[model samples]
Target: MKDCEFFFESKENVEQDGRVILDEYRTHLKDKNTREDINDNELLEKCINIVFEHMKYNRVYIYGIGSSSVVAREFKLRFMRLGLDVDYLAESHSIRMNITRVNQESLVIGISVSGKTEEVIEGLREAKEKGAKTIMLSAARVYEYRSYYDELILIGGLKNLAISDKISPQVPALIVVDILYSHYLNYNNDNKKEKLQMTLEHINYELEE
Candidate 1:
């Protein structure tokens, strides 16, 4: 009868808070969207050229936490499928030891919703110190270490929440990472566009069924 009761009854079928948040996130995509969308798209365009210029060496490192880390993994997989050398650093020990040094030509892509995440920031810091080209995907403004990074891609504007946050913020962050994937496709002359386009056409055709 009630929402809580329905949730309890369907506990096995229904997912918990994480799923709820993700579902709400998907739904929020249908909504009009917020200011973050514009900035994020801009960042995507700016990074595409740089990514293309260094297509060689092929090594890429991604850093982030929580959902942001999952997003980074998806980006890494997309790059890998496109034949680039991609690596993931989501843990404390691996991040510290594995990424100790990076090739000068390598690209280190860092994604952080808060931009204030200590681990990702520190990892990026290390990568930079070791001579890797650093690129940041963050919603927060550039901080004191601005000179250390090669590029900072800002996604989403600020939106404060009291008790619970609206989905308006989360979806745009996801979309920004997706935009990076799209940008890679466009930059590398990859068939992801035609492939995705064809897939969408098929989906639409099937929906008609």
Candidate 2:
């Protein structure tokens, strides 16, 4: 009961497996619901513009580890479907060895739930040194490595449900993706509709075949 107490924020809530899951769902819902409340539109717009800027001259590179890597690949694919060929760096050397090729035209997105994953942070440092615009996506409200990123996107606000049984980092990271991606379409829906449709059609075809 000591471990489960945090989930029952109010005395009115009782502890059952159903309650445990519903409470967990509420926490997730709280996080997802707050996505719009954070007023990140300005940053979202700035990110899209940075992405758009690179879409023309340079390419987008995604760097992450563990759960962040999953989000990185997903984001890369989402942008790629929009006709922007993106790079998701899965190896340590691939990011560092290629740092020489990164510049202002290049964009490196570093995703770290703790905002303190040393590998992601250090890679972003080198990328920045090479003049690449860097974006840090994390769940932390405040952290020490804030200085390394050109733009900070804090998505999952739920702070300390750190146990393995609890929901994890990738949940909110995807919500950020959903937020940024939905807005991207809204920003240019007229131009993007055909591409979106084509992608859906292709996916449907692949599934059918």
- Candidate with top TM-score is 2
* Candidate 1 residue-wise lDDT at 135: 86
Q: How does model 2 fare in lDDT?
A: 0.75
What TM-score would each prediction reach against the true structure? 0.68, 0.79
List the lowest-lDDT window of 10 residues for candidate 2.
156-165
TM-score of 1: 0.68
| Worst window of 10 by summed lDDT in candidate 1 | 161-170
Per-candidate local distance difference test: 0.67, 0.75
| lDDT, candidate 1, at 92 | 66
- Residue range 1-209, candidate 2, lDDT tens digits: 97568656645554555688678758666665355534578988998878777777888888878777888889988877777768887667776776877887889898877776777788888888778888888777545665677888877566552233566767768778877777777775556767766887888844344
Name model 1 segments beyond 4 Å from true. Answer: 1-43, 158-164, 168-170, 188-209
